[model samples]
Target: MTDRILLTCGEPAGIGPELAPLALESGVDFVWIGDPRHLPEGTAYHEVVAPSDPVPEGRLPVLPHDFAAPATPGRPDPANAPDVIEVIARAVDLIMRGESRAMTTLPISKQALKEGAGFGFPGHTEYLADLAGGVPVAMMLASTTVTPPCRVVPATIHIPLSQVPDALTDRVLEQAIRITHAALIRDFGIAAPRIAVAGLNPHAGEGGTIGHEEIRRFRPLLDRLRAEGMQIAGPLPADTMFHPPARSRYDAAICAYHDQALIPIKTLDFAGGVNVTLGLPFIRTSPDHGTAFDIAGQGRADPASTIAALRMARDMAANRA
Candidate 1:
C-alpha cells in the first residue's frame, strides 16, 4: 500500500516551488501544501480529498494554502508568513485527522517567517514540537558518509556556544539518548542502535582539564543509560568522534553543542542531508539546508536535499506501514 504524505513548500520565495515536481516521483502519495499561484507555469493542480489521489504526468496535485499577500521569487514578504505557517498547520491536521500518513517539509526562511509573521519558536523542529502538544523532540541529520559514517544529533540546538555549558545537563543528555535510541529501532528499523555521545569540552575535557561538563554532567547520564541496557558509548572526544576510523563504532553521534554536530554532517553531505524530527506524532522530514533566497527563481537551486527528504519520508512511511 502506498503511504499518503503532506508536502509543504515552506516559503514561496525559496526553491520549494521548484522542487515540488521532483518530490512527486518519490513513490508515495503526496499532497502539496502551498499557494497554487506559486507553482511553476504549465503545472496542473489537484484538489485535496479524503483518500488523496496520485498526481498524473504533466500535473502536480496541490492542496491550496492562503497567502496573506502576493509573492515574488527571491523577495520574501513577512505578510505571507502566516500563510506559510498555515501550510505546516494544514499538513499537521491532515496527519492528525488521518488524511495523510506523513509530512515532508521544504525549507522555509525563519527570518522571513518571523519578521513577516508571528511565531515564537526558533525553527521547524520547535514549531512541530509545539504542534504535537509539546512533545520533546530532537533533530537528526542523516546522510551518506564516506570516511566516518554516522547519524548525528546536537544535544543543545539553535543556541550559542557560550550557553552550551549551562544547557548540558543530566536530563537533557538522557532524554536525547532515549529518543534517539527508540527512533532508530522503531523508525529506522535498527534493532539495537549504537549511539556515541560527544563531550562538551576538548579531548573529553582533557580529563577535566579543559572543562568539567563531561565529568560533572554528561558522564553521569551516559552511565545511567548504560545501566538501562542501551548500547551507548561516549563522553568521547568531540574532535575525534567523526574521524573515519573511530566513527564505525556507533550508529549515531550525539554532540554537546549545535555546530559541533552540524558542521561534520553538513561538511560531509550538504546537498543530500535530511533533517528529521524524531518523536513527532507523525513523520516529518525536511531538507537539511535552508531557504535559498539568493537563487530562488533563477531555477539554479539544487533539489538533491529535497529529493533526499522525499525519498526518506517515503521509506520511513513504508517501514512504519
Candidate 2:
C-alpha cells in the first residue's frame, strides 16, 4: 500500500487551520489530522478510521478528533490543549504503524500549548524526540538551492548563549554530524555529504581570545570526524561561513548554537525554509515560521511556507518508501 502523508494543523487559534485547504490542493496525498469543525464551513471532509481507510475523493480527507468548543481564530483555549496534543500523537502512531509515510506539521504556539495543555519542552523538536521513545534528534533547516546549499544544525538549541559552552561536547557534535549526514542521504538523496562545522565563538575564537570552546571542544570534534573519513570541515568563523561563496562549498553547516545556524538560513529563505527533524524513525517536517497569533484570523496568513512543507514531506515520504 502507498503511504499517505499526515498533516497536523496545530492550534486552531493560529494559522494552522487556515492553511489546511491550500495545502490540500498542492497535489500531495495526505490525511488532515485535526478537528473537522475547524475547516471552512461546507468544505467536504471524510473521517479517518482504524486499519487504513481508502483515500477520500473530491475533498480533503480528515482524521477527526473531539476538540474543545468551536475554534476561535487567534484566541487559544486552554481547555483544548490536550486535544491538540492527542491529534499529534495519533498522527505519530499512524506513521509508526506504517499507515502513513510522513508528517508535515503546521505552526503551533508554545505559549498556548503550555497554558492549555501543561506541555513541556521548548518546542516540537524536543517533544518529538520524547514521543519517539527518546531518540536524540537534531533540527535541520533546509532550502532548495544547492548553489550555496545550506543545512543547519544548532548544537545548543533553545538555551541562552552563556550555557552553550557547557552543552557543547565532542559526543554531541559527532552525533549531530552523523544524523545530518544520514538524513541528507536518506531524505535529500545526497551521497557522502560534505559538512561544514561553524565555530562557537566570534571569529572562531580569534585564536582562543573570544572563546575556548573553539580551541577545546570544537577543534577536537572536527579532527575526530575528519579522521573517521566524514567529509567534514571547519571550526571556521560563523559570520564568514554563510556568505554565498562559502556556503556553496558543502552539503550542510553544523553550527554551535541555535542563532548561529538559524539566522543565516532564516535570512536567506524566510518563507521557504523548512524545519526537518533528523533521526526520527519516520519523516517529520514543518514550516519554519511559528503560529502567527498577530494575524491569525485576518485571512492575511501566507500559505507559502506550509505549502513548501507539504511538498517536502511528500518528497521525503516517497524517497523513504
Candidate 3:
C-alpha cells in the first residue's frame, strides 16, 4: 500500500488551518492540498510537487492551491470558495490517478460554498459520489475510543425529521445496509459483520402502539437479509441498542434517521469520531465535527477527531491493499 494520504483543507477560514499543524504530527504520511498562505502564521511547512514526498518531523508537506483572498479567522470570504472547492477536486484527481492511497478531509461549509461558488451538492459525501460516477454511498460514523468501538449509519441523512419516514424506503434501507456490510468486511477487515437495525420509534413502536414502520418495513427487510446468511439483528429499540452491553452484540448499528445514529456515538466519543463515506470508489474519511468557524484561528480547536480520521484512513487503506 502507498504511504501517501491526501488531505483537503476544507473551509480555509475555519479551524482547518489551526488543526493542520497537530494533524501533521500524527505520524501518518500525508500531504495537505491547500494554499500554505492560508495556514496559521509562522507555521512550518514544505512544499511538494507529489504526494509521495517525504515530510520532515515538526513540519507539514503541502501541495499548494492558491486561494484568491486571504483568510480571516472566523470570517469566511466568498472569494475563497472557488478555491476551497478546487482543493477537493484536486485531491480527488490525485487519488483517481493512484497518486495517493486514500483521502482524509477537513470540514467544509456547504452554505458558504453554495453562496460563494454556486455549489449545488448537499455536502462532501454527495459531491464525492458525483465525482465517482454516481455510485451508491452511505455515511458511517465510527468511534475508536469506546470499548468495542461503535460504528453507525443513518438510513436517511440531511433531511427533516418529518420527512425521514417518506425518504427511508425499502430500496434505500437495503442499499445502505449492503454498502455498510461490504465496507465493514473490505475496509475494516471484519469477515462477517454483525449489524443491528434500530427502530424508528420509542420502544420499537411498543409493539405497534407507537409506530408501525418497524414491523411493516424494517422487519421484512431484516428477515430477508438474515435468511441470506448476513449476520443481522433488530428493529430493536434505538434507546436500548446503544448501551455498552447491547453494543457488544453488533459491529454496527443502522439507524432510521441522522440523529438517531449520530447522537449516541458523539456522546460516547465526541473527540474521537470519524465520518467515513462507505461504498465510494476510493477510501474517504473526515472528522465527525464541522468547520469550527468561531475558533478558526484561536488555536483552541481540538485535533483529536482529525488525528483519529487520519489513523482510520491509514488502516482502511492498508486493509484494502
TM-score per prediction, in order, is 0.94, 0.95, 0.98
Most TM-score-accurate candidate: 3
Displacement of residue 22 (Cα, Å) in model 2 is 0.9
How many clashing residue pairs, candidate 3?
0
Candidate 1 residue spans exceeding 4 A from truth? 145-148
- Give per-residue CA lDDT, model 1, range 23-95, as digits (tens): 6666556778888888777666676554376556556678777687767888988788888898898788778
Model 2 Cα lDDT, one tens digit per residue, 184-207? 889888878889998888899999
User: Which residue pairs overlap in candidate 3's backbone?
Assistant: none
Error (Å) of candidate 2 at residue 196 is 0.3
For each candidate, what is the lDDT? 0.82, 0.83, 0.92
Off by more than 4 A, model 3? none
Better model by lDDT: candidate 1 vs candidate 3: 3
Screening candidate 2 with a backbone cut-off below 3 angstroms (N, C-alpha, C), the clashing residue pairs are: none
| Clashes within 3 Å, all models in order | 1, 0, 0
The residue pairs in collision within model 1 are: 78-116
Find the number of clashing residue pairs for candidate 2.
0
> Model 1 Cα displacement at 168 (Å)?
1.1
What CA root-mean-square deviation does each model show from the true structure? 1.8, 1.7, 1.0
